[model samples]
Target: MEPLIKIEHMYKIYNPGDDEVRALDDVSMEIQRGELTAIIGHSGSGKSTLMNMLGCLDIPTSGKYFLNGKDVFSMTDNQLSDIRNQEIGFIFQGFNLIANLDALGNVELPLIYRGIDKKTRQELSREALRMVGLEPRIHHKPSEMSGGQQQRVAVARAIAAKPPIILADEPTGNLDSHSTEEILQILKGLHEAGRTVIIITHDPDIASQTDRVVQIKDGKIEKDYWNEKE
Candidate 1:
């Protein structure tokens, strides 16, 4: 199968001269479609830098990134924004939902940016909520739901557009074991149903649960292993 995401010679430098910090150093990797992969590293290991590149949130100093076969760096800021809004579904660890918006509203947020009409976005958001098994709580605000449910709302928001890639950054960072597993299961379900899911996490257990693990240290990849245990 063709690769869903590819990065070559990626670099992110914080300072120019005497005080140079390489958040990412010559990182290159390929992620195929529908694969569940984990990028694991401690704080300041450049994993987040990698995520920023993959999500098109930041441009690399020097490298190439192709998402679904389109060169990411070749696009302008507005085009990059469109790439983020259309091609990738982001689920952050923080949930990041507006407290004022109910689950349905939170799920509809992204669709609104895509110029989706109210009636269509509402139905799509409702279906996404149902996919995450949160249909009954769609009307509840984020503050009214458990950590897992809020994350589910976030997931619903992500998949509502049916993006080709699901980029999750420390998706379970704030949840208990059960909630973490629940969210993981939902991500896994998405992968099973043919979505490329990349998880950025520090937890070994979480990394192990993924189909493949790529370890990073000091801004470079240490090991790229396909988990036979899976």
Candidate 2:
């Protein structure tokens, strides 16, 4: 079977007048379904750029990218927007929740964009919040919950659309050890349930838990390996 995601010779050059910087250099990668992959690298290693491309948030300057065997660059703007809304979910380091919106509200935002009816959105959002073990905190705002709970809500928001792939960047960076472990368990559960999970982080400890690891250096992939022990 074909890979769920395939990126070939991808390049991203940010040209702001005289300062032309290459964020990604001939980067190539493929991620299979039902796998948790961790991308590790230092600052300016192009890991973030690569993540943006993989998440369908940014287009590459050159080369080909295919998500679910569909050419990413060939997609119309609306199609790409639809993919971002429906096929891929994103969890940011900051949680990125609207401060005033409660957990259920935040989780329901994406479904609302999809034009789903009110009753269906509420039902789906409730199911997603339950999946992340955040059912009890559905009505609580971000500031009203602990960091781990907020992150759990964020994860719920990401998965509410039933996206096939989840792109999480530094998911555990701001959490304490206990919270980190909780978040890790949640991600592992998602992966075990047949979802594709990709994380970008600099923490070796976090990378160790994933099923696969890809190291990047100076905008290029240095190593990619699968961990069968997972």
Candidate 3:
């Protein structure tokens, strides 16, 4: 079967002169559909650059990125925006929820952008909130909720549209250990339900929980391996 995502000899260079820095130095990888993968790297590592590329947020200086067999670089900005909206769900470290919007409202925002009808958006948002164990908090605003609850709301918002891929960047970076565990379990459940989940983090503990780990260092892939699950 064709890989869900493929990147070959990818390079993201900044400045492009004598002082140029290669954020992604000739990196290449393929992710199969429904794989739970982690990309681990420290602060200066190229993981963030890779995440930007994967999420279609930014273009690489040079490389071929094929997402679902479509050439990513060849797409226009509007097309890339549509792809980001329709094909990938993003969960960021800072629970990017609207302060004025309730949980359901936030979750419905993306569906609304997709031009979904009011009735269908409400249903999908409610179901997504339920999946994240936040049904009771549907009407609660972000400020009224705990950090974990807010993050769960963020999760619900991301999955409300049922995108095929979940791209999470340092998803548990701001939470307590308990909250971190909760988020991880929710992500695991999403993976079990057949979503292609990719987590970007510097924590080996988090990476260990994923099915596959891809370690990045100094803008290059240092290692890629599958974990042995019992």
Candidate 4:
């Protein structure tokens, strides 16, 4: 099967006066469909830069990125925006939910942008909440739920669109051990259900749980290995 994401000699450079910083240096990678992959690196190791490129939020200065077989860098800004919304779901370290929006509303926010009808959006949002085992908290606001519940709601929001890929950046960074385990299980379930899941994390324990782990350092890949037992 064709890879869901293909990167070839990717380079992202940030310029400040005469100084240039290489956030990603000739990074090449391929992510297959339905596979759970983790990008592990310390701070300033270029993992976040790679995530930005993968999520289509930032374009590389050179090299090529093919997302689902399309030349991502070749797309116009408007087209890239549309693809970001329709093709990829993102879960952040901070649960970026609207304070006023309840669980269902938060999950339906993206569908609203897609111009999905209210009835259908609500139905699908409820289903998403159910998928994350958040049906009982659909009416609750973010402030009213525990960190784990809020993160689960965020997961529901990410999956609500049924996007082919889910990009999670430090998803468990703020949760306790129990919550981290809960979140990991939810992510594992998503992968098992055939969704492409890519995570960026520094935590070895978290990285160990994925189907494959890619270690990066100094803006380049250091190792890429599959956990045979997982």
Instruction: Identify the candidate with maximal TM-score.
Output: 3
Off by over 4 Å in 2: 16-19, 228-230
lDDT per residue (tens digit) for residues 1-230 in model 3? 99999999999999999999999999999999999999999998999999999999999999999999999999999999999999999999999999999999999999999999999999999999999999987899999999999999989989999999999999999999999999999999999999999999999999999999999999999999999989
Ranking by lDDT: 3, 4, 1, 2
Cα lDDT, model 1, residue 122: 98
lDDT per residue as tens, model 1, 1-230: 65888899988888867998989899999999888999999999999999999999999889999888889899999999999999999999899999999999999988998999999999999999999999999899988999999999999999999999999999999999999999999999999999999999999999999999999999999999998872
Flag the better candidate by lDDT, 2 or 3: 3
Superposed by TM-score, candidate 3 places the C-alpha of residue 28 at a distance from the truth, in angstroms, of 0.6
- How high a TM-score does candidate 2 get? 0.95
The lDDT per prediction is 0.93, 0.91, 0.97, 0.94
Residue 52 in candidate 3 has what lDDT?
96
Off by over 4 Å in 1: none
User: Which lDDT tens digits does candidate 2 get at residues 83-152?
Assistant: 8988888999999999999999999998888999999999999999998888988899999999889999
Point out the worst 10-residue segment of candidate 2 by lDDT.
16-25
Cα lDDT of candidate 2 equals 0.91
lDDT, residue 175, candidate 1: 98
Q: Regarding lDDT, does 2 or 4 come out ahead?
A: 4
Q: Indicate the TM-score of model 1.
A: 0.97
The better candidate by TM-score, 1 or 3, is 3
Clashes of 2: 0
